[model samples]
Target chain A: MAQFMDVHHGMKGITADQLREAHQADLAIEKDEGVHFEKAWADPESGTVYCLSEAPSAEAVQRIHERAGHRADEVVPVPLTV
Target chain B: MAQFMDVHHGMKGITADQLREAHQADLAIEKDEGVHFEKAWADPESGTVYCLSEAPSAEAVQRIHERAGHRADEVVPVPLTV
Candidate 1:
């Protein structure tokens, strides 16, 4: 499985509770796409959120996010990790 | 200390060798700013790079990247992570 790091913008004023809820939303249906959301980080101040996941492709990551109601602004393949 | 996720854009066609070298450059001088780069991921096609680190502030991460020669385009404080 390939790991991905996706960025979400325009989520300004999102609280910690909201972040968690959104994360859960993705997790709930991630398995349907053979995706596993491993970790998420948020900067509420900048309305920027980052999610790390293992999936078949970047599209899979996007689908999960979009279905969760917060489409990611950018989804990049992280082929190299260190 | 806080964790940060920074992105670097516009480095298209970066090879594995180049990415490794760049990561080494940051690791070499990261201590000067009391920063530790935990990991880095890159997508040569998108010319986008994401770096995860533990630092006192986003500025510290930026300083290390700038001194190492590839300044990050965006640095967001990851106050909440899960």
Candidate 2:
């Protein structure tokens, strides 16, 4: 399994509730894509959100986010974590 | 308390040992700046690294990284997490 970090841009000023709901959207159907979204962090001031997940591929991670109503602007493989 | 995500660029082929060593370097003296580096992720293919930390300010995070020898290219406050 590969770990992925996906970034959502232009979501500035997102509230805590909105962030949770967006994350929940991904979790709702991640299983179909073999993705597990572990956590999401957002900087409301910058309007950016970052999500960390374990998935078969970066595409799988993107797919889950897209289906959840937001598409990730960037998805990078984080093969090394410490 | 705030969560920050910092990015490091131009280290595209960093090895696992190198990554761990770099992280350890930051951990070795993080307390001096009141920063706690929770984890780090690297994408050797893209030569990008992302760090997650709880810090008093983004500057403190950057200071620790700079002192550790790998200055972050970008640092953003991720005050919201889920």
Candidate 3:
């Protein structure tokens, strides 16, 4: 499974709690897509939401996000860690 | 509290488990700086490590990362969420 970090813009003024809720909702439906939504972070002031996940492809990540009602602006594969 | 996302480059070929350990180590000492290391993500293929934190300023975030021995390449304040 490849790791990915997808970005969402224009989410300013939202709260971390709310973002968590949305993330959970997405997770509820993600298993069907073979994706695992690992973690999420948001800056309410910047309206930025980032989600990290493992999937077969970035398209799978985007498809899940779009189905869950928050499409990402960018879905970049993360090939390294530490 | 302001949220920030910091990125570390050249971390390729590392594992998620290792990143988590480093993040935990940083958390153990982060309280002294008043910065909360919330979550982390890494891409072994891309050599990218990203950290999400809550702090008074971006400088605080950088300071904490520097202290943790993984200086960030970029620390950008996220002023909004969704």
Prediction-by-prediction clash tally: 0, 3, 28
Clashing pairs in 2: A11-A47, A12-A47, B12-B47
Q: List-wise, what DockQ does each model earn?
A: 0.78, 0.94, 0.31
> In candidate 3, how many Å is residue A50 off?
1.1
Residue pairs clashing in model 1 are: none
TM-score of decoy 1: 0.95
Model 2 alpha-carbon miss at residue A13, Å: 0.8
What TM-score did chain B of candidate 2 earn? Answer: 0.97
Looking at candidate 3 chain B, the ten consecutive residues that score lowest on lDDT are: B73-82
lDDT string for model 1 (A1-82, tens) is 9988888888788888999999999999999999999999998888899999999999999999999999998888888877
Best by DockQ: 2
Question: Higher-TM-score candidate among 1 and 3?
Answer: 1
Tens-digit lDDT string for candidate 2 (A51-81)? 9999999999988898898999999999999
What tens digits encode model 2's per-residue C-alpha lDDT throughout B2-70?
899999989989999999999999999999999999999999999999999999999999999999999
lDDT agreement of model 1 with the native: 0.91
After superposing candidate 2 on the true structure, give the runs of residues whose Cα lies further than 4 Å from its correct spot.
none
As for TM-score, the candidate ahead, 1 or 2, is: 2
**Deviation (Å) of B14 in candidate 1:** 1.3
Q: Quote the lDDT for A68 in model 1.
A: 91
